[model samples]
Target: MAKNTGGNSLKLKKFLNRDNTVGYVFALPFIIGFLGFTIVPMIVSLYFSFTNYNMISAPQWVGLKNYVRMFTEDNRFVNSVGVTLKYVFISVPLKLIFALIVAFLLTRKSKAVSVYRSVYYIPSLIGGSVAVSLVWKQLFSTKGLINNILHSLGMARISWFGDEHAAVWPLILMAIWQFGSSMIIFAAGLTQIPASYYEAARIDGAGIVKQFFFITLPSLSPVILFNLVMQMITGFMSFTQTYVISNGTGDPNDATNFFALYIYNQAFKYFDMGYASAMAWILLILISLITFIIFKTSSTWVFYENE
Candidate 1:
């Protein structure tokens, strides 16, 4: 028996080594791209973060000047940070909740479910396009379709892009409208949950609300955590809607200026590549910290059956 066990171990090691060789052969292109694009750019960005490099000139070592200015001197940086935080916290939760509700509704098995899922997912496929964002911007303009309908209803006219208070609302709406990705994930998670649990819960006198609260939520918490992290990251990285809608200005006095937009403006618009690199690193660090905190707290709320 001992000899057989040793032979099995040798065979397993040989199989694993062979598998790894085949995997590396298949992954060669990805490995090259990763090294040339992602890893190299990250290393260069880290170095540039410590310097002041305009596109036209060599980088000058500024030590921590860029970081200091970002924290203490740049009001636009502060505004962008605040705007990003609000967008992430508010939009992430709302998007996830909307996705969860839709997922639940869509889980009711029907012949039309596949078609309905594809139809709903259309928005996610097109939501980030410049044309769609342009249309959305026009939709909320002073004399646009929404306000026209409002006026026909005897409502007052309002400037969506001219007011700081209202400028970000349309963006949030756009974000929520594209909850299809999360909805699909939730739907998949819902299907994984055993029907026996629900049947048992019903037998114990639980109604819909109680079942959702006590069974469905706990079972779906892992999926929710995944969606939350992904959406939060996407929220922080969001730029296209703001860029296209505001014509790359993040208008309404910068009310819709997200972190990525600010970084873009700093890099390309002002040619402050070094400062932009610093901002990028800051964003990376911030994302890492937020993700870490979520993972740390996940053990308290995120449930897994095998665990």
Candidate 2:
């Protein structure tokens, strides 16, 4: 019996060794790529965040001075924070709501539904590009398409890039137009809902609005939460639209000065790599906090059939 036990132990050790070898072999490429690309840069950035590095000389240790200045003396930082928060809170919900509405319409039976979906989804595919952003800028420029339409219709032309309040709207509107990603997610969620729920609601004399409120919304709450989180993250990280529309300056009193652009300016434009790294870390923490809050509150409304 002791001999048998010793043999089994040896066999188990060999099996584990063979399995470990196979696993490591399969994972080697990803591990090497991560170490070379992600981990090394992240470590260097973390180190840089604590030091003053202007990309011209050796890094000087600054401790938390950058963070301190960011909170206490940086008015642009504060304004960018406020602008980003406002942009996220406003654009995310509106975009998701619009996506949901469009998803509802698309859920209706129609042979043209496929074509409509493709058409609506195309904007999202190319919306984040420099060319599309330039197009949007042109559309919202003072003498551009929108104002041209207003002038043609005997209305006053609004200054999109000159007014602090109105400059951000063009960016927000452009963001909302790229609702195809959320809309597609919503459409998938809508499709997953059992049709019998709506049918039974109708049998009980429920109106369209009632059926939607009672059956559709509750069933799709999980998907709504998903889309909300995703869109909110995207809104907070948004750069191209505001950058292109405002000519990379977030002009007109800096109403559209997003945090990302601010970080870019600090790093490349101002040569404050350390400050940029600190801001990048801060943004990451802020996003993580918001996502945490969303997830913490999700249990209140997100429904799961398996639960």
Candidate 3:
């Protein structure tokens, strides 16, 4: 019995000393954090989504009532969905395109180009902050800098916030303005493309436009896919700008009531924890479905050099 116990202890020590075990030890902090902050909260929120919990009373399981209310009983919920979709679709593509253009332009080798990249990237670093949002709100206000510029140009001042149609544009423009991260990614991808490919294209009588379409675009497709997915997720999850610009009211008439802001209002302002949870789950599922679709379709367009 003593020999057997000693053998087992030796085996356990050997196992613990293995490479895989060491890797796990290194990864333990991330694992604990993911479980504690992400997985556990997700499970709790899923449970809350099906219950009637106001953070005051004990949770009462209601089973799909919150979801039904979101679809059938809440006009604001439906409008918020529409507004969020509109924002995501409009801002994401334009932002990606603009980022690609800026990155392409900045691909030249020069000391000033690096400085330009840093200057352009500064907006993204501070773009999502409350202070930036407040400044953006003021810029679009009736007598703001933008209106002043238009007036100087002999154009009439427009009501940016009062008009529902115009209200979403400022937010969309803000979304597009913070394209620095995507631009940096695109610039990196551009550098990875072999110069020989462009040389061969030029030799083959390919014009600049043709070279861009046939070579640059196809070469950068994978990066574009990655940027698209990430930006779309960010666009859908946008809240701070809307919350600040609209004064947490989602006015004029919920025009900027992004799904995220709506969820915040439900969770904190209205104290509808259950409903907010349901909305959050819906958003998660929606983003997952869209990402899945993009990945599925990417096979047709996204190219890899290894393949």
| Most accurate candidate by lDDT | 3
Question: lDDT of candidate 2 vs native?
Answer: 0.89
- Per-prediction TM-score: 0.91, 0.91, 0.94
lDDT of 3 at 276: 97
Query: Residue 82 error for model 2, in Å?
Result: 0.9
Report the C-alpha lDDT of model 1 over 165-249, residue by residue, as the tens digit: 9899889989999999899999999999999999999999999889888988999999899988999999999999999888888
Question: Which is superior by TM-score, 1 or 3?
Answer: 3
Reference-based lDDT, residue 149, model 2? 98
Score each candidate by Cα lDDT. Answer: 0.92, 0.89, 0.94
Scored by TM-score, the top model is 3
What's the count of clashing pairs in each model shown? Answer: 0, 0, 0
lDDT, candidate 1, residue 183?
Answer: 91
lDDT of 3 at 107: 94
